[model samples]
Target: MQWTKLLCNYRELQLVGTLNGGQSFRWTYNKDTDEWIGVFSKTAWKLRQKDDYLEYQVLGSLLPEFSGNNTQIKNGNAKTCEESIFKSLLEKYFRLDVNLGSYYKEWSAKDELFKSACQQFYGIRMLNQEPVENLFSFICSQNNHISRISSMVEKLCTHYGEEICHHEGITYYAFPEVEKLSEAKVADCICLMSLNHLKALPVDTHVYQIAAQNYLPHLRGKKNVTEKMYAEIGDHFRLLYGDLAGWAHTVLFCADLKKFQSTDHKKEADEGVKAKKKRRQ
Candidate 1:
């Protein structure tokens, strides 16, 4: 089946940022097809973002064990219910309910460092990814760039994962479960999904650098910041920010890595300040 939905007010839901936000790595863009390909439930769903709508096609569902269940069709609500389910999944996955404009306003007012990030990456929303997958993916992320992280994840899936589907000669597999990874000695990364549940920031060096320069001045003159301070710095940001601090951390961390530019941030900040001054004047 196929579906489409208009994702209005999606300036913040940039596909570039969503795929590149250092989260799940299965998403890729094929300029030739003008579509984004992501694997879900072993299906390579092709998605395209138009001006106001996301058009999607579910190539085919895999997991043969689950496919033969005609229960939904027998119930007679399959079409309507499944369509609604897909839309709801898309919304929740992309966090469409979040008011990016409001978050930008509040975060910008909160601090200069965040103000810069918010301005630079104004429309970058955090992807509310699958918890178990996100948990182990970050484990593979240590000292690794996004490309490497993605490659490792692909390998992990191909080797240990259950085959989902193949489309256009490309095969997509599910991420191996924690137990599978544990059996392979990659379980070290499974125990910790602390990136969100505990409300800790995904504070890499970029975030740490930004935090030290702007918030934790105590680390400014130090040559090396240790691992313990990662949690400490995250704690400090959450105190100032709140529960969604991890989301804010994703945007800001992108800036710190220069994945998002400082000049754009500076420009946005300058314009915001000018607007404020004009209002006061």
Candidate 2:
């Protein structure tokens, strides 16, 4: 595929921050080429941002399974492995449409700590990851670190997921879907530790410490933070930060880790208010 380039402010979205920003587990940085590498849509790809533009290049052909959603190219005279496909996938996956710089500016006005954190990671934005994959990754994150979570997620895919491609002797497997995961034995899935669920932030040491000390005092320095407390603190954050609470959580919660903890309480509350007005009417 021809090299594809898209212009983006490096100060708004970056490869290093997003890939390692406590979300995705499959991406790797190739320092020699200054590129971030990962497999998506059953294809291996390399992405790098230079100056003010983000560049994309796919290493190998996508497997047949990635065809159904991409029939537009499949039927066209152009190559099945077009740069446009990668561009579209990358844009959607990274959520390039949302302006992180604007968000950071909005958050900086709200809190001093958030201001500092945002400056440190000015370009960092919460990746809008697929819910199911995000859930399983966070599940593996319990009592584990990023490197370990990544390994566990990889193992889950390799053991249960369908093989997508083989290049440079490395076999890449798509992250398994619900049906694929369900087909596995309970014992095996447990052993893999890849079972999935999430509502609040992907809580880690930083978020835990912050919650214990500043956010939720119920724990009050207690070593144990319950799942209930996690949700409560997350809800409290939503109340404080409103619509962008998830993105705000991402900025304040982590130095080594980043997560967006928020809920749709605002939307729900608005709906309730509208319902009460309708009754009065």
Candidate 3:
């Protein structure tokens, strides 16, 4: 496998936050190599980042190549065709066309809390995931945490999704298609998050707590989120953050997660150490 350079900045795309910050659960971080391994669009990918760009390695067998009209192309340049298709898929998956910095500035200007969150959490962008995979994975997300959700998603893929490849003694599977997930459950807000409906806010316990304390104070003492309250919470965020409310909601959600707290603290500490070293010099 050859590593292809993907034009991206860490500020525009933080692999850790984007992949593990609760949007999709398939990606696993290899701490030793500082690489992310995951499957998307029926292909397994290995990704790592540098200062101003990303490096990707396509793993396993390449899927059948098809043109815009879904016709298989038989040509001598099949390898080139696969690379072209994969590159385009990567761009679309990350929604690389959207100017995240501009949106961050715009969102920060509108909301004070979100502005603070932007300072701590940058480069957390919404992924444009496949609808069938997104729908089924998020269905597993309901009433679950990231670890368990990931396990469930893995099981689904292992049982139903096509086998992609084996690497480092572990096997990767493509996310099962819609037909394979006929009996699977469903969830709404996260499905919207994956589908890039920026205004759709999926309210869960954490979001409800945040809303009760900051946005909707009336529900402070409530035990659970009722159906009516769910819509109201979604409406509140949409009204506050405009069309990309869901994107803004993600920043806030990530900020509130305990999982990211230690990572942020360690990063800040590392930066502090680097600054001190500069001062000593």
Best by TM-score: 3
C-alpha lDDT values of all predictions: 0.65, 0.62, 0.79
lDDT of 2: 0.62
TM-score of each: 0.76, 0.73, 0.87
lDDT pick, better of 2 and 3: 3
Question: Candidate 2's residue-wise lDDT over 99-142, tens digit each?
Answer: 87776777678667777666545566556555556557666767
| Count of backbone collisions in candidate 3 | 0
lDDT string, candidate 1, 1-281, tens digits: 44456464435565655676665688987866657888654555668765456776655444453377434422333465565665676776677787778877787788777786565466676666555676667777888888899899899989988776667788878877778875222231232122234254655566768888877888876666677787688788788777767677767766666544557645744564576457557
Model 2 ranges off by over 4 Å = 61-81, 183-205, 214-219, 256-281
Better of 2 and 3 by TM-score: 3
lDDT tens digits, residue span 68-147, model 3: 42222212222666778878888999888988999899888988888987766888888888888788777788789999
Query: Order of candidates by lDDT, top first?
Result: 3, 1, 2
By summed lDDT, which 10 consecutive residues of candidate 3 come out lowest? 69-78
In model 1, pairs of residues that clash are 12-123
Misplaced by over 4 Å in model 3 are: 66-78, 183-187, 263-265, 268-281
